[model samples]
Target: MCGIIGVFGNDNAGRLAAVGLFAEQHRGQESCGMAVSDGLLIRLHKKMGLVKEVFHEEQLNALPGKIAIGHVRYPTKGSATEFNTQPHLVETLSGPCYALASNGDIVNYAQVRKMLENEKVYFKSDNDAELLVKYIAYRILHYKENIGDAIRNLMRDIKGAYSSVLCTPTELYMFRDPYSIRPMIWGKTPEGTVIVASESCALDTLGVQDRKEVPPAGIIKVSDSKIEVLDNDPNLYREGNCEKHCIFEQIYFSRPDSFHFGENVYAVREKIGAALALQDEGLNPDLVVPVPDSSNFIGLGYANQNGIPLSLGLIRNHYIGRTFIKPEQAVRDESVRQKFNVLPNFFNGKRIVLIDDSIVRGTTIRKIVRLIKDAGAAEIHLRIGSPQIKHSCYYGIDTPTTEELIANRRTLEEIREITGVDSLKHLPLTDLKTCVHCPENYCYACFDGNYPVGVPDVYN
Candidate 1:
């Protein structure tokens, strides 16, 4: 997943963009970039690092414009390198246009790239962002009378989840894939300054009023004085037929303070905790302990509603990098220990209820359980905030194949035994809707095997 933001108005465009990106830093930490349009030229600054590390005050002050776009990217499908960083500016025949950023994966990237390559369209890198830019540029070459018509035609050629922000000198535009697998929200300051971001938290940081979500398979265009909704396909509004919004957004991806589709993320997590408590009514643990970071909200909710004490029995090392060590089995085992330290005083001699988001391959959960067990916990109850992940995610998440998912082959009881936990509870797939407050809008394809977008035959 990635985070994107675009702002129109205000001379300190780069600084505003940086502020928005900093608010969205949790979405992506690998790379950060910002591009500013001064009506005459587009000035760009991007690098492979955290927001604070990449954009210094001098750099932000140097890019002068009243309009800007920014991005913070996490490498899911492409190699993590400076070349792949976004806010990619393309000089198309329809004048210079900037494809700021997008937050979802394109499953048909390989096919699309191959088709473009067959026509001798040489590319600078293997990143999907560049491919998307080329596709948009190509379409604009044919349909330049109206930008909306060009984008509509381009959408028909690609298949996958995409929530994007594109900007020109005169306007800022937001596009959501038909399925809305990723989150995108727009808001305006009291002074009428327009802002679009991957999450509402960014707008909150900028003190902007919360606007409605960019509808699925919809486009919103903002100019100096007007905002227009370009509905390329109205059929997507059909109830129960809209594409699924990624479920992971609520579980681990989104900021706890943000809201998506009118549902507050923190509240949804609390609901998940309540569901877990109800599902495993028999496990009367002495304390509810969160795994830290992601699961803290849900753990608190569970403890509050179940009348169990909530304790921070585990502490996470905030400095751990995504690729700190190699992906080798031995290295993976060692990293888990280094990443988390159990508070022996709190966990010892206590029946603990451990809450986590989801178990991908069960390796990390097993290691965490063993760590807690070694700390002298009398009994351990595993509570997952979401349903079992039985299928792979094609829309940007780095999940393994079905054969590798533990839930695909083993039952909950078997998993409990494998992890050495006294009891285990997972939220049911049916309860996911209730947790998110959108029974029909959110996507649970990862748990139910129903993909909103077509899965490609091959992926990188």
Candidate 2:
């Protein structure tokens, strides 16, 4: 739901962090920020906007350091406010020093925050990133534990998905939760500058190759000379108590070029499209069109495998951000207006197969189908690349109620009628598992109600 990156051993660490944040802008759009550490001090800059809008050349130049961490914000946990923007700073009397940015929702946040409050810890914002920073500072400054021991304890205590990168005045540290519900990869540039980001695409933008994921429950410390593996503990993961890697990351959240959880994101999506195509071979469609950005490669795979000609029947406005992540339904519907347009000739008088990632609330897709129909398409066959989402997501995603999910409330036939499509087919749960690299480890809680870490009592 958010993007995080840290740059170490580079003089233009702030600029590199800015560039990395721009590459990861898709992961979050509500806000963006960067924290730079020059070993003596940490300079922080954050605001509410896209990456380019938030930071300018003058601001980036002012934040000079050898190390920096950046974040793009999507409101998975905190309210939409400038006060909640990250990387949340932890300051001593000296200056704003330790900086932390993390990518997942903490399920036990309320309990932890309450405990911290009872212990006289004052909180400035409702953001869980702030809690994480305070918790780490508490462990290091209060309990007198080293960074490695503090992080290990954090893994044991924090009971949810969090892949985090932190910048101390002295060192750069990155770690994943015991479950590894989000993605983190690190690579070193030819100049020996090490980079840790939420996705490989961030590194690719920086011209850094030879990337590798920080394994589940793994801690990585990047220094000038070498990268150290802090904690290799696998007690929870080996026993299968917390082995659920996020399936939605491959299905929707990640960029196609980025690799995560032992699979190429694009290849996995392509395989999913091919599998969906196989489910309806007898059906014929004159043209195959993807629902713009998210389903592009999936449509390519379907068109290539089924020998159906692919065309861009719908043109997406790159100026618009993702609508589904918007806070309200009215806002999302209004966003859909500017986000897509029908190409004149492609949708008229043709049997079109519309490929899309998934149908959540069915509001956006319904509007898109109306556009295609208005463009004079003779028939619309909507093929979704993922299984029906029958439940809601609690870990970092916005949907948290079953009532908000369309597939949970309506039958397939009813849904097809509602969308006004000639035919509708969602990729089956079984096929979806087979399409991924590690089928067994995926968390299909939203599709099948098989909550890996168990849904909170509040949702129930």
Candidate 3:
């Protein structure tokens, strides 16, 4: 998944978008970009780096406008390169210019791209954001449709998870896919500046108030004259009437401070931890040690429920990025070493309960277990906050193949052995459902292979 931000009615739109993008840097780290419009022209600036590196003070100053849209990208649909970076701009000879940034993958990318190609539409990048902007631009130019009409058509035809922001020279529009598989929230500042982002935390950082989710199959347009919110019936485009937000967001992905899908992110994580603890009723450990950062809240719940003292035994290097999101296996392997370290004199002769969000490929957790083992821990009983990820996630996450998943490749006992932990358990699917306010509204396709939106044909 990626992070998207849009700002309107602000003179320093570029700077404001940069601040919001920085708040969402955890969502994506490979690249960041911004498109700013000053009522006459849209200036685009994108680069292959983090938000701070790409959109420095000098870079933001160059993009002077009252409207801006930005993106922080983690490669899912395209390779990691500047060309695939987002806020993709579409300029035409007839003076209409559009820039778009999106936060989820497109399942029908290949088929739709071929259809657009047959219609003689040229493509520069193989990214999904490019396809979205081009498709909308194509409709506006050829079919004589307005921006909202073109986006509604896109929602009906394009099948995947997309929380998107589109900006023109005069207005900014935000929309989401039928399933609402990803989070999209928007609000207005006290000064009347409109803002939209993939997560509420970003909006909070920008001083936005009266925040709300861009509803399922929803479209919102903001301009100088008015703010229009067009809420559509999601059942028309999706299989069921209920929203299918990705459950993994609460387990991992999202920042704990954020809120979405009608629940607080950290509260759901704590509930997941409590559920995990419920399964290990008999076994007790000396201390509960989370793998740092993402698993902290889970460990907290587990500790609170089990009456065990929680310890921050593993310290993580803030400079290192998340190992799981690294593109290459070798890079991920090397990052584990730099990312985490065991506390001195902490694990000696102690039975430790280790907590982690999930074991996707099982590489990072294995190394973490090895580190604690080397520190003379008596036992390492591993607990995962989420259910086993046995299937690939095509809607947003980068788990493109089942073969890459440890749960799919190995049995439970084999995974315990592979990670070198004394015992291991994952939060059951049923238990996970109980942790959420609306269990039916979330998608657990990665755990049970019951895809709400059908997988791509190649995977089928």
Candidate 4:
């Protein structure tokens, strides 16, 4: 739901972080910020806007240091406010100043916040990212725990998905939750710069090839000398760790070219499309058309398997962000037309198989169907790459209320009737499991209502 990156040991750390963040601008657009460490102080510059809007030559120069971390915010868990923007600078009295940038949401927010507050640990923001920074800082500053112990303890105590990067005045630290429900990868450049990001696309932006991922319940440290794990223990993260990485990230959140969790995101989506096509063997349509951008790869696989021509029937605006993940339905509706355009001539009189990632509230799809049908398409056979999302996700994605989820309350026929699609079929559970290959390593709460971790009271 958010994009975070850390650049260490680079002379142009601020600039590099900016480029990495720009690569992941799709991850978040509500707000952004960057923090750089100048050895004595953590110079901070963050605001309620896009990365490009918040940082420029002047802003980057103002915050200069050997270590820099950046964040793009979609705010799945937090409200839209400048106060909740990251990278959050944590000023600890007992230790050196550091900043925190995190992806994913914390499920045990209420308990953790109350515990920290009862200890008189003052907080500046109401967001979950701030809780993580304060928790680690509390351990290091008050308990005199080492950085490794702080991270290790955090993994043991925290109860939700978090793939995060932290930067001190002297070193950069990165870690993932025990479940590894979010994506975080580490790469290094020939120039001796170390980079950690929410996805490998950011590393591609930095031209780094020598890469490795931080394992579930894993931690990485980068200093002037070298980048290494804080603990050399061969058995901790290796022996028995339950790694239920969010499969949705591979299906939608990540860029198609990005490699995450040891698998190419685009490749997995293509396989999902192939599976969907195998299930939809008997149906015949004139051509396959994608909703644009995120679902393009899935449509390619579907079209390739079905022996139907694939066309860019819907031309997506490269300038706008994704509409489904945008916060409000009013904003989504107003932005939907601006985001996509149906090629009237191309789709004229064609029986089109329209492929999209998944349906959330059914608002976007209803509008899309109306657009294509109004443009002269005779029929729209809507094929979703994933199964119906019936449960709200607590681990970063913002579908928290069941009432807002169309599939949770409506039957398949009702959904089809509501969208006015001639026919609609979602990727079956069996087909989805086949494509993912490891159903056990995924939190399928949104599809099957099987929460890997206990749900928060808010969701209940």
Best by lDDT: 3
Q: Model 3, 103-129: lDDT tens per residue? A: 998888888999899999999999999
Candidate 2 regions with alpha-carbon error over 4 angstroms: 93-96, 237-242, 457-460
lDDT of 4 by residue, 1-460 (tens): 8999999988789999999999999899999989998777899888888788888888888887889998999877778788898888888665698789999898888888899999998887888889998899999888889888988877766678888999899999998887788999988899889999998999998989899888877788888877778653423532244578888998898999999777889989899888878877888899999888889999999999989999988988888877877888898898887877887587788999999999999988898899998899988999999999998888888787888899978999999999999999999877787776576777778998877766874555
Q: lDDT of candidate 1 vs native?
A: 0.79
Task: Score each candidate by Cα lDDT.
Answer: 0.79, 0.86, 0.92, 0.86
- Which model, 3 or 4, shows the larger lDDT? 3
The candidate 3 region of ten consecutive residues with least summed lDDT is 451-460
| Candidate 2 per-residue lDDT over residues 372-442, each given as its tens digit | 99999999999999988888777778786788889889999999999999999999999898887678877
Candidate 1's residue-wise lDDT over 1-460, tens digit each? 7899989887777788899999998788788888888867778888998898888888887888888889998776677788888877777554766555777787788899898788666677666767776777766664454667666755777777778888777777888877777898888888878888888999998888848788877888887778899867735432356557787888888889999877798988888888877776666888999987789999988988888999999989876533211234465566677888887566778999999998877877898899898889999989898888898887877663677688888998899999999888888888767786567676777888777666765844
Whole-structure CA lDDT of model 2: 0.86
Report the Cα lDDT for residue 124, model 1.
72
Report how far off residue 47 is in candidate 4 (Å): 0.8
TM-score of 4: 0.97
User: Candidate 3: deviation at residue 291, Å?
Assistant: 1.1
Error of 4 at 29 (Å): 0.5
